[model samples]
Target: MASEDLKEDQEVSFCLNLFTLRCGHSFCRVCINQVLNTKEGSGVYSCPECRAEFKEWPSLQRNVTLCNAMENFISNNPQQEEITGISCTYCVHSPIPAIISCLLCESSLHNNHLRVHSEEAKHVLTDPSSSIENRKCSIHKELLMYYCTEDAACLCMSCTLAEEHWGHQVEILDEAIERKKEKLSDVLRKLYMQRQKTEERVQRLEECRGRAHQKANREAERLNALFTDIRNQLDDLEKRMHCEISRQEEQESLSISDLIQKLELKKDELSRNIRSIEDLCNMPDPLTILQEPDMGDLCDPEEGEGEEVTGYVDDPEQEEADEDSKGDTGGDYGFQQILHTLSNIISDVNVVFYGQRPADILLDVNTAANNILISDDLKTATRTDKKQNRPETAESFQCFQVMSKERFTSGRHYWDVEIAESGICWVGVCYPSIDRRGWQSYIGSTNKSWSLFIGRGYRNQCSVSHNKSELMLPYQIFSAGVRIYVDYEAGQLSFYELCDPIRHLYTFTTTFTEPLHAAFCVWNKYVKV
Candidate 1:
């Protein structure tokens, strides 16, 4: 029983030495010394367990009963605390009534107040010089006394007197602090609004990116489809080109085969003709052997002469026939007959010559309508017939005649006459003036003698003849004449003679409707006559 009591006492004694020096609580000397030395120059020696710091070491008066009790209690209950009251360092009269104490002033205070005392009272509040030095004026070196509302800062008394802050209302520090707080609140509200706008812009950009991706995907798909179509078209084109080439090759091959076949057939026919000619040359010539007589056999017929001694003198006709037979022998009858037959065939074939043919003319005897009027300038040698109802202006004229058999039989015919004055002549062939090839001429001849001959055909060749007679007269008579020719067949025109066969001459005539000078404005311009 005594040993058990002694062990209990030993346990309590071990715990009592574990308090810290900073908090006036017993602890291991080594543990307290490590904490005190870590913060040696800070004037704060803190307890490791309770974080209680002291400026100086407390009196080491050991409380025997309490320390033993605490030691036993801590050993049994490891988390127990000692509820000790502390005194305030700043107000010595007030009891701190807390577990911690201020290390700097060596006065007891609350655990929380111990930290505040060093920062606010011991270091900053106790040093009046540092406090005044830290409160520097923001604008000037003078000590700040007032705050400017407009400048949003503390200003020295001298700065407040400046002209820049003349109209601005000055305030104390308390009031400036309140205003700055309100302004900060406003700035925070604006920042929130700007944040919302930025968020909206980001959302729009995200949507735009999504749309761009979709469009790019669609374009890629379309391009792929187009490429596929192009490939298909190219394939089809290749097939068509290949087919065309094959067809051309087949046609060319067929043409070559046909040409080869024709050549082979021609070669076979030539070979057969050559063999037949060789066979004909090999045959013997009977005429050649018959012409040669056996004269030796006739002289050696001694035995045969006795048997038939009726030999008489050869006839001159027989000798002459023998001589003639010798001369006619070896003649080539087949070759001569072949040559003669070939020559006859060639001679019998007709040969044609190519050139022009003679000309022939045809004339149509037709009358004009009664309504048309003839011109007045026309010359009339004799008025065989007259119409009472004809217009006096003579705008048109028509005449018709049937030729006799003698006139038709004439090979070539022409008319020669001289015009007394300038006039227009309307020539016609086959039909009336409507059918003639028309011509206009300015007459320059007085008593001009002209000759018109039958051309290659029956067509009349009209020209402006200005040749005048050399005979001089008192009155100048513009005599221009034209000749008319008749052709039974239509023919081409020639200068003076017939052209060739196949050409025919045709009959033609001319009539004057009006005076040439009046109808063609000949009076405006004069020609040498």
Candidate 2:
């Protein structure tokens, strides 16, 4: 029981107002003061635990380390009223509260035990519960005071002298940690900025997608409405054709009905005459019969001729022939009617397609052939046998065909070319990308060209080299002026004879795959635009 009481008192010893003398022995400050007061005239003080004497009442310093240890110990074991005093971890000793901890040895020891432990182990010591023992090199059992910048770890002085860390740059641990923290902060700032930009890009893409979807929907609705209108027109045309046929049939039926009514009237008149003759022949008295109306006039053939009635019979063959002729004429009439309607439609479309639009007709001087001379107005071109002295350029056409400056990729256009009297030329349009040096550049010679020839006969050709299919116009049309019309949207190229009444000569139809340029080939003749 006495030993238990001593142990308990030792455990709570650090919690009191403690003081340490030069001999490194700790006791309560009040107890130390009482001892000092009793030895006032002795001119000397003594340590309670070590029994070491000091000269002139040795100065006692407060044990701050022991006070901190006591606070930590109490806080950690708050539920327990008393603590099992810490024992010396290095040597066998009775339980006592520890005041110092060895960092290298990782153990807590009392003052007496710490002196012996530090001498034998050469371990660094600190206040108990300070956790300095954890900051030691495991391999060398030394305090880690330096940080290896290359290895990015805390290291001891012994490690810096070893082969592994030799010549490696190092800094103090606190300074290294501060530099790493600054670098990490910069990285975090850059990451935040990148995230913001990515979010903005995602938002923009979403807006673009939404707009595209809306435009597509609007176009689809417009197309649907246009197709619906086309279908309605077709239906109306069908109804009109059927109604015209029904009207023709009704007119023919009325003619037949009139013929029947006339025949019936003639039949009734003849029957009345027959009944009159029978009554006169059946008279009982000869005098009464002779006296009965002009019997002599009836017997006289010449006089009766005027009284005789002849009923005309309808000719079945004649009726059939008439009907056959009407049927034969109806086919041609229907065909012409359809042609007329289509012509009207084309005329209406032309107004919309070519309404006061700018003319895309300009001569490119760079593309003129060496032997060709262009008028000052840039509207006429003429070829001569003598080659003009002009510098060679990429845009110059090696062949006779020179492309116009303006290129057409869409929309409609019309232009007229007046051929010089008795002069021949080729006028039309060609793709700008066609070979300018080879024979393929010639108008109507390659697939990229379509032209009307005003030479021997007015003929139009398309890719004549591959397939020679040319359409000849009338002689009158050749003598007259020529007009070229293009509906690029519909892929139509039409030539017309500019006579009193314009006559369509020929038309070339194909989907234009590239921008087109009006090309002219003046073969030893002048052609005006």
* Alpha carbon lDDT of each predicted model: 0.39, 0.67
Q: C-alpha displacement of 288 in model 1, angstroms?
A: 12
TM-score of each: 0.28, 0.35
Q: List, residue by residue over 6-103, the lDDT tens digit for candidate 1.
A: 54655543533333243556655445556656775674556766777565533232344555565455457432123232234455565444434432
Per-residue alpha-carbon lDDT of model 2 for 1-529, expressed as tens digits? Answer: 8545544765643434566778888877567768767875665667767778866546556676876566555556443212434455655645666776777777877777755564653465665643654678889878887898888779988888888888889897668878988998899789757865664565466457646645665555654544454456557767887887687667656766776677677668667767887887888877877776664343444532322112222567865776577576655226556555555445433532223543747788888988888878888788887887777687788856577888888887887777766666778888877777877667787888888877623242212121234555544434446777778988888776554334455667688899888889887567777
Model 1 regions more than 4 Å off: 1-111, 114-145, 150-153, 156-168, 278-529
**Residue 61, candidate 2: alpha-carbon lDDT:** 63
lDDT of 1 at 275: 72
RMSD to the true structure for each prediction, in A, is 47.8, 29.7
- Candidate 1, lDDT over the whole model: 0.39
